[model samples]
Target: MPTVAVPQLSVADLDPATNLDAVTERVAALPDRVDVAVFPEYALTGFVADERACDAALERDGPELDRVRSVAAAHDLAVVAGYLERGAGDDRLYNALAYVAPDSDTTVYRKRHLWAGEADVVTAGDERVVVETPAGSTGLVTCYDLNFVGDSAAFAAERVDALFVAGAWPAAHSENWRLLLRARALDGVRWVVGAGRTGARNVPDAPLTEYAGRSAVVRPDGHVAAALSRGERDLVADLDPAVLAEQREFIPVLEATENDGSTRRNSRPGSRNKNGV
Candidate 1:
């Protein structure tokens, strides 16, 4: 089992190009044996308020993604980050997660679920993507995508070992952030590694987008395994798929649910209410 490093990125001062450089440097500085480095949503470009800004978004093989690939290859690690994506033919843009593996072609997962005001600028994605890596079979999703049942359900069907979420989730809805992460972990029966942004971004008409940075790694049993500080910075934690299996076997909650869809009729294993009381 290898540890995944979640970097709570602060984009207050850095521009897209500067952020890429900073991210590359940060990834290079991590422990040499890390299997994956996860970054917050819109890690390269700060959240865009208007469609015009999204118009300036980069392509998958553009300079921004190229930089991420270079660092992942150099560090011998897989990298996952969110970015605004521009389509080649039309003016449509997408909120996308890019998975870059060392010496491999980059894979992009467009956000399947759109947030409020997001559909006005970006088109919704139709499919879920899972990339096979040395560490595990990994799936990627953006902020609001985690809220959609279909997205994670698709990943569950794929039997992915981990779900990497990159988000600009705001602090105002911290509870949603926490609950959604846990729910995704439980439903997918895999580790949920979330990397969220901190500080504020200028979005027109809406309040400044701020991230709570409760970014954490949730185990298959729906417990917070490890977390970063609330504001910003890097945190790492080891993830063992075997532990997930152990917990699942001990309780077999997912298996039971699969057998009978009635939650009220079945006694859940290791089940705790939200308060943990």
Candidate 2:
């Protein structure tokens, strides 16, 4: 069991060159003894209307990623963060989550589902990825993906101990965000860590859309273990795998579902909706 930190900071206009330093500094201040730190989706590149901006995205070995790697190595912690990754052969890009081990190569989890206004520029990933870490087996899913029941079920099938979700979820849909996260935690029967942005983004002629930073960590029992402020902030909490295992054994929800397809085992029934993460 290790503590994981979720950072909910403003992206500061999607400029990675200038923002990476600040982001790194903030991450460095996180609890040094924690096992891992998770950052928001597109934290380096703010949500943009023009998808072409994703083309300018970096590679896993790019400077932006290198900075994150350095932080992980410095702190001796696993690091998970999202960025836009340019495809080598195609013009399209992938919204990717990079899992960097201290002083090691990076593993990537590309977003499998694209959101509205993203089809033109982003390519969808074909499969889910779960990486074995020092702490445990971890799965990565972007914000929109969590809305899909199949995705979480697949992770459950994989027996992932933890799921890391990064996003730019808007304030108008805060309740939806909370519900979706709880649903994922309950359905997957695993720890859920969600890190999202806070503050507003300006659209050309329309009113600004505020990103509600309700970053949180949920237990296997679907209880909120820890949370950050609804505004800009950083928060961390210790996660005890032993406690999670105990709870799973007591409830046996996932096992019951697998054994008999008994709807009686689900905490929430008939709530499956596809809005891919």
Candidate 3:
């Protein structure tokens, strides 16, 4: 069983320093029994509509991330936090998740799909990364990525044990957030751990938009095991591998349809890249 904690917190708009402090304190507060702590999208740098986003983008190897890594090392738990990344060639920016572990080097997963105002700000990612962790093999996805079934199926083909999601979905469509998570869980018979932001984003000269704020830990059986409607509370739950094993044994959903439903049992996994976004 892998104990996971999903912290439902608000992003301090364009303020990485304050967010970094929160991340440190939150990581330190988790119980030793927890193997990982997941933070919501833009956990460190909140989103902005225009070029001001460039100001929020941090280098992957920048001091900010080093600080996060140090905190993870000290706490002895994996931390998956959403952040804005500055491209090597100064391309644009990327909506990314930083998977910082105690024993391994940090793994960064960029968001493949950009939503609404995001397409103007960040470049899409090209690869599908399944990171192996102490608890299990897991895949990462940011906000808008949850709506795509192929992304969920792509990880299912890789046989990932879990999918960790970082989201800042709007309050108006909160049901979609919960719906899509369960759909993905059933799609792969795997655990879906989602951390969503709460509170309102007060960007200058723009209408204030409130976040959905319903963070959830969906079981392999597609049940909502634990969740937070709104607040700064942490949703902690132990994901039992046996539950996944039993679900696979009984339903065998992934076994029947492999790799985004393009390949059935004996078929070769699709040659083309399955765009998961």
RMSD, one per candidate, in order: 9.0, 7.2, 5.1
Whole-structure CA lDDT of model 1: 0.74
| Model 1 regions more than 4 Å off | 12-14, 203-206, 251-277
The clash number for model 3 is 0
Query: Per-residue alpha-carbon lDDT of model 1 for 1-277, expressed as tens digits?
Result: 7778987887642267877877887797788768888998878776565645564587776777778878887888888888778876777788777777777456777787788887787788775666665447777778887887766666666666788889788889978988999999988788889897887776555556667888899998889998875766787888886887786677554443332111111012112124220
Query: Total clashing residue pairs per candidate?
Result: 0, 5, 0
> Candidates sorted by TM-score, descending order?
3, 2, 1
Give the per-residue Cα lDDT of candidate 3 at 192: 91
Colliding residue pairs in candidate 2: 14-46, 144-276, 144-277, 145-276, 145-277
lDDT of each: 0.74, 0.74, 0.83
Q: Taking the tens digit of each residue's C-alpha lDDT, what string does model 3 give over 133-207? A: 655778788889988878787888878788899999999999999999888888888899999999889989766
Candidates sorted by lDDT, best first: 3, 1, 2
Report the Cα lDDT for residue 135, model 3.
51
- How far in Å is the alpha carbon of 226 misplaced in model 1? 0.5
User: Which has the better lDDT: candidate 2, or candidate 3?
Assistant: 3
